[model samples]
Target chain A: MRLARLPWWAIIIVAGLAIVFYSFFTSPLYRRALIFVTDDPRLTTTRFANVIYDVRTDEGGIRRVEGVFVGQRGDILNVETSRQVTIRVPRADIAALSCEPPASEGDCPVDATITLLRAQISGFLIFEDMGRFRIVTDDGERQEVRKFDVIIDAVQRTPENCPPSPEARCRVVLPLNPEREANQLSGTVLEANADDFLIELAPEVIVPVRQSDIVAVVRYTPAECALNNLVGCDSGIFLTLFVAVIAFALAVVIGLVAGLMRISDNPILYNAATVYVEVLRGVPLLVTLLFVNFALYVWLRDEFPKIAPTLQLIIAALALIVALSQAWSKRALLKSEPSSFWQPIVAAAIMGTTLVAVTGLFAANSDLPPLSRGILGLAICYGAYLAELFRAGIQSIGRGQMEAARSLGMSYLQAMRYIILPQAFRVVLPPLGNEFIAMLKDTALLTVIALPEMTQRARIFAADTFRVFEPYITIGALYLCMTLLLSVLVRAAERRLALPR
Target chain B: MAETPIILVQNVSKHFRTPRGVVHALRNVSLEVYPREVITIIGPSGSGKSTLLRCINRLETFDSGAIIVDGIALDTAANINRVRAEVGMVFQSFNLFPNYTALENICLAQRVVRKRSRKEAIEIARALLAKVGIPEKADAYPGQLSGGQQQRVAIARALAMQPKIMLFDEPTSALDPEMIKEVLDVMLQLAAEGMTMLVVSHEMGFARAAASRAIFMDQGEIVEQGDPQTLFTAPQSERMKIFLSKIIKH
Candidate 1:
């Protein structure tokens, strides 16, 4: 009993907050920022100069000097050190020279933190006149370093306010070659030439990249999404629920109306409902969805415009028929009673106006959005099944119940509302819960229309990551958990509402 | 004899179309009951006694003739609800609403058709439940109550509409032997109060004890009708004799 008294709402609130917090911190923007700050030093590190010169001392031993290579003046080589001093070295004493910045060590000093990329030759300054730089690496492989090879330069941040003179040391990022990070650039190649390929980096921005550089080429099919927000966070679940809940709501309305019509005493109403049920039920749900999305929507967009005016004319003709019927039916009374002459005409005019409005509303919106089409397809398809279910539930009650209510002098509609529907609702509850679960799962089929529901998101994840089994298995587990939870809730509701027989 | 008849059925006939064939359930059945008169109808199986009672309230529409209750014709669509409200019916199986309690079952029609407020309906229902001798069982559902209690509740439900005439169609036939006396006791009290009643029953003891007139019916037609004592003692027709002989032995 004490455990039962525990505040379950508090626990749910805390759990919900935890999920939202986790979703927020791990969002793509924050993840990308974290990567920029923590990636390999070649991408973020900065230095004043990245030059190293190895020369022989007067004692016949070799010593190395690191600085920015200023220039060569005839017999002396000029270099600027981190201490802001220019030093001259006789060209004759020079043994080996390398432009690659040395790693942090006791002998090699750097003004700021910096890291260098590995190449046969590395140098701080490349001679643009020659269009190349020469440096000796630790491996001693003499390779040419071209100016065009360095794609991105150092990135700098704004200088923060410092004391005294207001000058501040700004943090700078190091330049890196584009080839090393080509694996991260996953997109389609827009245009390619011998020297470079024009690649679409994002939807709106395209950049020219060297042909020799490694690039991740990703080919996209028409069905696949290039960018979709519903796949992010836990929005896929929300999207699925949105479709299922809306479709279920619409289906309930349709099912109630059709179910009542199916059981009607009138042949016209019954036949209309029967035809609707037979046609919708005979077609598979997937085919219905495809027909709604592709065939119906396409026709509505392209062909419905031409037919809408004809539909209006047909509706007007039908309204005229209804008016004529009304007038003809009351002709004898009208002829006998002159004061009631305008009654049938007024009634017909009102009914005809209402009919036109109802039919004209549909003709007004020739094209429906994709999401609406998907929801409509699900609703109408399941509505037929639910209509049968509702009919069965209503029929399950004995005839005596109706008679008893009727004998009480209650109108037929009142008796149905007060007696029959309440009992029928009880009888159909468990089946209704089952339909909801089935419909929830059926929402996955809408991925054919490129809806970013849970299953669709999983498909996209599998295609992007090339790990086919993991994403699908995860989605299956999620669906299992959701359905199991829904089942428990429904059983609880049933228990709560149960009455002794 | 001076009072106007509260219910008049004139040449009323009903035919049911079954998959087997069309069968005449009621053939030119006619009856009249004055205000405060208690009439009990006795019949063999398929005698059309129940059909005649149902037609009086238009629960089952007749193929010909007319039924007028409390001077209101049953043929008029607008008058049907009014006539039904004036005439109450109790079924053989005590078709009490299982979804409602005994009190609510009585209150439903009063609140809906009579447009009584909830409090007023509840007050009237409580008074009627007490009158039926099941005041303590008012909160119990029909399913939970015994057949006698359910029948009493059905009587209270019918009386809650303040109807002018009451129609009983084998009201005690579904009850146990012990339970039948309790239901019959309520009907006897109603008879003593001089309520206009039409009862279809096989209980000759009740007919002999309370009915102002006893009728014998067979083959969808009334065979005999007379004072209860005279009709029970000296039957006029062979059909009546055979029916009485067969029923009286039980």
Candidate 2:
């Protein structure tokens, strides 16, 4: 019989690549390139662009006309006048520029526009003049020849320009500094106003700012004195490091208890472990962070007026520890148990309940301290998963082994220690490695609580500059690298621990 | 020559609480085993031969009995482990620890129960393995060996404990036909060495060759007891005659 399907991994990889590619191409700067190609014909013919625009480089240096675009054939199309000059091009030499409706009107026109516009511009724009064009389109259908406004939108000069469109209107070079011409831009704090602010630029543009679009308003306040307190730096670094260390230590302790409890013959201990795992694993880390910040903090503050902050941290850690331990122990127990039909279902149910409870509690509190709470939350969540790894390792020994040991006059504990556990642990190492990597990724969940882990640091960096997408991409790549490294480490460990052949 | 028997059983009876209700496995069985005498118990399946042997080591508790081994009563927990140590038992399945090498299997009881030093235990294990005719296989795990080799290892393991009496509970029952002779040879050698052995087996030829006295059991009670040659040549009881006829024909 013919095979019924595509390989599942291939499908998943293709889907993931598609998503990453889509996100990259649909970003704002990328969208600008698509618009450039659709509006300027000179960019299409020359396949090059020399765009003079201000850019903030890595060292925070502001440079004007930082880059120039050269075509594959050494042609250079200046960004200025490229759009207007496109009107003079003959139909035969126009190459191609096409405009298509956005996939979703409510959503931004990044993917559909770029994909369609790139196909139209590729044939006409030699590889060189691709960087000069600046294209603009709007929600409304009306098309008119207007001077390009480069200042209103911060434009960065890069060697690469967007591909052209089928309509020969691929590149549009907006005039620089229209605001400077009109004398409307201002950087100085002339007035203290909460709703509006003005910033002066060398080459500015006049653009109407809508109230709905503005997210933040700030007034500049500068202090003349530079204090070398060093206290702030110490406390910030210390606090972050402290949370990470404490969370890991607490996770180890709680994991042991939970693991033991989960395997205990007593119904109460087992059920409690089950409940703990479910509640912890069920909730989203963000919600857990919020609960710790808001409700937990308030409750503790009320309960202990003088030591409320200390108690809040303690309580959050304890809650996280309990949650993590519960999760770990239950997982360990399930892993240790013989392969029975109900084992996985029972484990899943417990995990689900714990996660849901944790998320609910976290959501209720939004004002908790970020780093400590986030670390604690992640520790608790992954502790359960780790516990199962331990359990699986311990339980992999055969029953016959125990029986044989006992028959040889050895006690149960002795048999387990000498004959069974060593073998079982060897079997469990690979999965344990996987759990460690998973736990590392789970550290990102702390971002919800405002702990400035790598991802959170990236977020702060994004917010400081308005380049949000790059920071996120950097964070994603970092996470991928760390996880991949961990995977390699685990594989190495597996090989080391593996039984002979 | 009339020293009191080393082991004595008086009106011993055992009942098993199985899933199918109570089974009266042994009924008013009585026997005496003298020092350095080989007594072989021959019976069909469910004849309580193993239960009787296990009772001596207290591996199986008798419902009603007074068993005396080496002047110590067998019912008390105080002496159970001690009695088990003194009376080494070998099972049909060999029950050797699969993970351990044959030498380790032999030395385990010696080191753990007897508290022998590792060096002493190893020496004893090597000697016992050699006695069982597979000394070269002492370093092999049970899984790495054949059924006959494992059984030999099991015999060596039991012998390494240095028990006063050895109990063989169908030691050759689980072996392949070709492997059975090797295990039987070991037992025969043990018998020749004058080990006070209580053996439960179906091997009529081994019983004739090695046993000083042979007992036939049926329905949890001994039906006949005699010299092996007389029992085989001319059975006294109708049950004995019938049993012999059936087994001999097979």
Candidate 2 per-residue C-alpha lDDT over B1-250 given as tens digits, one digit per residue, 9 for 90 to 100:
4988889999999887899999889999998889988888987788889889878876666778789988788654445556666787788777776556889888876777678999999998888888889889877778789898888888787777787888888888888899899988999999999899988988988998999999999889999997899988988889878877887865
Give the B-chain TM-score of model 2: 0.96
Candidate 1: lDDT of A53? Answer: 52
Number of the predicted model whose lDDT against the real structure is largest: 1
The stretch of ten residues in a row with the least summed lDDT in candidate 2 chain A is A114-123
Best by DockQ: 1
Model 2 lDDT tens row, A121-174: 112221122234323332212123222322424433232354443233334333
Model 2, total clashes: 63
Q: What is the clash count for each candidate, in the order shown? A: 3, 63
Local accuracy of candidate 1 as per-residue lDDT tens digits, A384-490: 99999999999998888888888889877788888888888888988899899999999999999988777887777666434554456556655766686788788
Q: Which stretches of candidate 1 lie over 4 Å from their true place?
A: A1-235, A312-362, B16-21, B242-249
Q: Evaluate all candidate structures by whole-model CA lDDT and list the values in order.
A: 0.70, 0.60
